[model samples]
Target: MISDSMAEVLRLLQLDDGFDAAAEVAVRAAETLGVDGLTVSLATGGEQAELVWCTDEAAGQFEDLQFTLGEGPGPDAVRAGAMVLVPDLAQVRAGRWPALTTESGALAVCAVFCFPMAIGAIRVGVLTVVRRTVGPLTDAQIGDAQVLAHALTGRALGATVLDQDKAPLLHAVVHQATGMVSVQLDLPLPQALLRLRAHAYSSGRPLLDISRDVVARRLRLDLNGNGDGNPLPVSDKD
Candidate 1:
């Protein structure tokens, strides 16, 4: 018997001929799961994951936070190629994702469930669902999410090839800024990205905002110590 949620997913797949069919289905799945919102990210070359779509601001913010901190259920699901369901972020050990735990508290996010879109050993992407309330998903909700994840894997494979240009690459600016930081500091891309994260976290600013400043040349990061002993100094370009 086709579950109501799965039935809706199939109906959307068949009827929605829009460019972002996968996103539409994902949003419906989020509704069925009773989550506040969700985001979909496709793994790019190497360790990068591009944010392709998000249902709401909170979802997008959480995704960006994970991207900046390099921790959280989304990243863990991608790395482990398995689902990482967090009933309550408060219950998570401090060491599990120390920075993410501390930072995410500021957002209206208390629960996150990450479903990795994978087939066999090949990982396609991840679907991250977030909620304002704290609790595990009901068994039926979990099943519906699994159905969505499986469907997304196939959809993502085709979308990655055909809709590559149309899909929003939200993190493209971050990568561009990372490269600029790498050149400015004479550091590798990884280290440059770390510096960007550190500066953002220390300033209590969004990572994307910091990256935008770097790309615009409005903010120059120097080795001079800020009052907080942070080596990255935020200064306007002369």
Candidate 2:
């Protein structure tokens, strides 16, 4: 099953155009982990998550809940660059995202785990797997998730590049833009990317959309931070 899952993951990558493969991978991964359901959220988008694929009917509520609210394990995982696992949503009561957690219970999500998707240093999105029971992931499962992350990252990378086009999310564009944004803002690459994210979210737009504008001279980083970790910028093409 693991091998099959891995193969399915590779096939998902081959898609390079649709969500069908991604949905298949989610289902296969769930089977491999013996979990209840799974969903893969691609960060190639903006503040709002774009579902690359989700397995089963149950994944719908979980995925839509996050998209509608703009908050959930997937969002937090991408923001914090860490995985969030709720072995049982009902058991968590304090300091958790009240709305997101509450919705988790409504979705009947027992256990949820997320992994960030990134190429080299550029983050693309997150992949989340959930079960209906409380328990810890075994070492083997962790390894499997890691492999899935790597494969998903590759898929995202391939999809964004338009045959030698230096896209902002493309690894080459990311590195180059990071250097330029860093020098322009006098911030590190990480902070520059954060600034980019900040600018996009503040405008209620997608990060990639903002990135393209920036890369194409249609936007400039203004650097007037709003303390929400969002950077200020002027859009040339509003």
Candidate 3:
């Protein structure tokens, strides 16, 4: 039986019936779950999940950081096919998410909860909730979030089949930049992507910014570890 909170969220989702319904539901779900904000990301393939919708800037930043670093409650929940409830980021042990932990210290986030949207063997994506106040979710909130996650899985699948192009591709440029980097460095795609991520982490910049620079031909990574560990700025002139 769907709880009142879950029912309300589902009703909001039904009102849209378009590709953008996911965004509406995300905002409603965050309110229902009593969190500060939330984000929904759907798995594209091979450990890559693209952010489709987020309730606020903090939630979006948290999700983007996870994608850039490839480690965090969202990825862990997706990998394990279970929920990762971190009531307080400060309580987490060091090295759990080393780069994320260090980088996110300045953010206003204090708690994070991740729920995997999956059905048996098929995994769809993740629903991540964030709160500025450090505390575990209420039992009711957890139950409603799980229900919303399941509903979102079906919505995501339908969106893929109905209007795949209309679905937001927040990280499309990043993937294109990765491919370009791979060819430039004569490295495999995975290695090239890692180099981009490494530079983003070390330079304390968003992955999207670094990728934009690469795709725009304003930055080029080399094989001498300069691009990986210390990226050099390139002039816009050819």
TM-score of each: 0.63, 0.61, 0.64
For model 2, what is the error of residue 23's alpha carbon versus the real structure, in angstroms, after optimal superposition? 3.7
- For model 2 the local lDDT of residue 156 reads 57
Please provide, for model 1 over 151-194, each residue's C-alpha lDDT reduced to its tens digit, 9 standing for 90 to 100. 66656544322223222225677778878987997765545666
Best by TM-score: 3
The segments of candidate 2 whose C-alpha lies over 4 angstroms from its true place after superposition are 1-8, 11-18, 159-178, 181-238
Clash pairs of candidate 2?
43-124, 43-125, 46-207
lDDT of each: 0.76, 0.66, 0.78
- Compared with the true structure, what per-residue lDDT tens digits does model 2 show for residues 21-112? 35555676778777787777776456776776778567667877876777767777778776776666667667566777766666666777
lDDT of 3 by residue, 82-199 (tens): 9999999998998899999998888889999999986433468899999999999988889888877877765654432222322222577877887898898887665566667666
The TM-score obtained by model 3 is 0.64
